[model samples]
Target: MTTVLPDLRPGGGRSQQAVGMPELLQVIWHETRTSRAAIHRARPDTRCDLRISASAPDRELIGTILLDGDCACRDLLVDMLVECDRHLSDRAGLLGNPLGAARVHVRKKAVHDWIRRRRTEVGAQARVDRIRTSALALGLPDEFHRALLEYLADEAGVMAPLDSEDALHRRLATRCAAEFGGAAEHYRARVAAGMTLVERHCRSGTRVNAGTAAEPDKVTWWERYIERPMGRRPRRTDKPLVTAAPECGDGTHQPPEPASADAADFDAQVVAVLVAALRRQPVTPDAALRAGLDDLVSQGLLPQRCAIELCSDCNRFALAAKELSALR
Candidate 1:
């Protein structure tokens, strides 16, 4: 006669010690034999088969029951198999995932809050300041509070004017922009760069050698000479390099000249390469610039300064280094 294992659900509720392989085996047997939902929910089709087994005994160790069964057991065994495979595959990171990382982050945050709350010696202002610092560290945008407040109000069923659909949407949009604008800009730059490259590569059709291009300095000089003329016609009345006296010049600072089509094309290519790199990962300004520089280097163009920093300086990107730096 097949002996039935005891239900074990309530008896196995809590444990001071960590779970081990033996406990896992008990849980699986209990779940399969007693829990109708566990088996019925995992209805395996004809194609799949379930199998389980304990690892082969090594010196001084005994082997536990290995689960082996038909399709139903195979489906259930998949979870265990994955864990085993992970150990064999990449033992160091076998079970790591983004969701697990996020859970750890949230737990840490809660622990920090609990510790702060328990410190009776700390003043309320100090507590508030600590929270603000933590928020800044987590890269919470300034606008996040407004959106959060609105959301909480709505969730609590508060009938406040600010909870109106229009107000809520506006609040959400503002927060999203503040939180994600930099990331969005980086993504946009990459897409634009890729499209430009595809167009150029397709249009050019023939491979061109970089050796044919003029030296970078020669090119710069030629551009300057072409754009403007050299003449010793008039020496501007002596102006000291550093002086308290206001430097005399035309009231208006000249805007940057429109780029030539070729220059624009080169820029588009650089943008494309950097954008592609950013899409793959969050790049440091140095890394993004390096990617752009690599493309320029390949094309025999002078490497310009870091692209993101230049964009920041020019007020092209919504968020600045100072803002993202706050997160770090």
Candidate 2:
């Protein structure tokens, strides 16, 4: 029987074979984002809430717009932002030269914090990535592939192999029967027969034991388990949307005040993005910040002047002040 590259993985358990690509994406997105949020919340605070005085300069209101998928929105946002930046530079030139630089520095720090947080979260997400890769390699969708690998990894040691023809025959029979009983019984019988045939003909490739005592029923088993039966690809599951929440250690009160929606939202979004970026090894804090800023700016959720700050230790965003309005 011919096996697709994807079907060759000898081991993911029944459950792993059920997870599809979309589901894997969702799991990765959720777990990475969640961990990032938690770590950010736990980070030590940075006093970034700048006091906006009565004489504060007017600037453009910027926000990030989030869209599903790895699409072309990023390029579009960059083009638009480049065009809009002339006004910002001009305004900065007017701010006595040094103030503009200072403001830029502050914003950079905030963005850096966002990147650091992502790296932190990414640290916890390696397993998801590996599982997804394994699934794709095996030609299984996120649902069955990932779930099966995870199940096997968790239940049986990840090192276990499922390559033996005998093992394949037995498991496939059991799976077919369990998942599709009525039609599968016929499949089970057919595979059993094939196993018997392969055992007779194939036997040991080196040892031509054509006349030996029943050759392990290899051909009949292979035919019944692999060649004859019909197999249905499992459906992929939809990933549930996740909400990024602040952790208790975030130094901010839970259920932020209704009036403080702006700050709270800003905090949540920046922290979430930051956390997501930090998952990379040999992490780049600046790149992570740029990622978060780009996400927010594209979404139109942040003003041009707002900034994000990272904690030195955990590399996630930190809210230094207890009061939202006190600094802003």
Candidate 3:
């Protein structure tokens, strides 16, 4: 799935990268201008409430654009965000001020408590980069040519490993099936093959095993889920997205039930196979994020019901102040 992201100026690193929220908002708004209004007219289902405001505010206008704007531009702005939360750990080891680790942890959590659409995008990008690299090294022939690993870069976590436990993994697989108009298993197998190649290479080289995972005190991603961003990506914007999903902490929500027993069973089997395969591979960031979730579950630190419930309440909120176009 070569996605071919809209000319989001993927090479746009000069002035845009350094700009703050206000400027970034203006830039994307400018870029998405014409397409925004057209889409509102094109998609009558959006029920867009068009109101002209001469002095409303750029923030509110951006929110309206993102809520009902073109998907391509919306995706591009998501990619353009800079991940700025300095980390205390990654796939490497403990980093930053260890003496102030607790304080830093709190501060980082505070950052996460803000908009996280960018960080989530970063995670998906990270998965694509590493997995794509591993795919090349293993001579998998253009990734055995798995799905091109590009679409997810624009959307959500579509590049996730087939067997991994991230929320969007199955969503990608399902979409792949729909896009190709069937051959569901073939698409699923491509995803699995990408992960399998990583496992194969790691088993053949120096790597970490489950023993290091045997820590009695619950090591957490502190050992495994380090971010180690090369250059910070996806910085937070000052405002939140007014159209973002509800947060997980709310009590009046419910976890999404599976469409059927068969679908649920299929997802469970995929996870089981993926867990077994990855144990033979290295605990890189991809391994850690996916496998770490499993460890948390097995240790009873994160129960299945709790994890499922959070998905319903929605851990997927974007900044109220993000992305392009439509003005009415």
- The most accurate candidate by TM-score is 3
Error of 2 at 29 (Å): 55
lDDT against the true structure, per candidate, is 0.34, 0.33, 0.35
| Candidate 2 structure quality by residue, lDDT tens digits, 234-288 | 1111112223344668555333232235887667766665556444411433334
TM-score of each: 0.17, 0.15, 0.27
- Candidate 1 lDDT: 0.34
Off by over 4 Å in 1: 1-20, 24-53, 56-265, 271-328
Q: How close is each model in CA RMSD to the real structure?
A: 26.0, 28.4, 19.0
State the number of backbone clashes in model 1: 7
lDDT of 3 by residue, 186-246 (tens): 6666655554543344344433321334663332211112211211122211121122244
Query: Which segments of model 3 are wrong by more than 4 Å?
Result: 1-27, 33-122, 126-136, 139-142, 145-328
lDDT of candidate 2 at residue 215, scale 0 to 100: 48
Could you give candidate 1's per-residue lDDT for residues 1-328 as a string of tens digits?
1111221221122332223454544443443343224344333222333344445354332444344455444433334323322322332332334223223433344333433432221211113333334422233234344333223222222112231222334544454456557543343333344323332322333332212356322222111211111111111221212112223475543322324358778667555655654544343533333344444444444322333244323222223322332333
Q: What is the lDDT, from 0 to 100, of the residue 243 in candidate 3?
A: 27
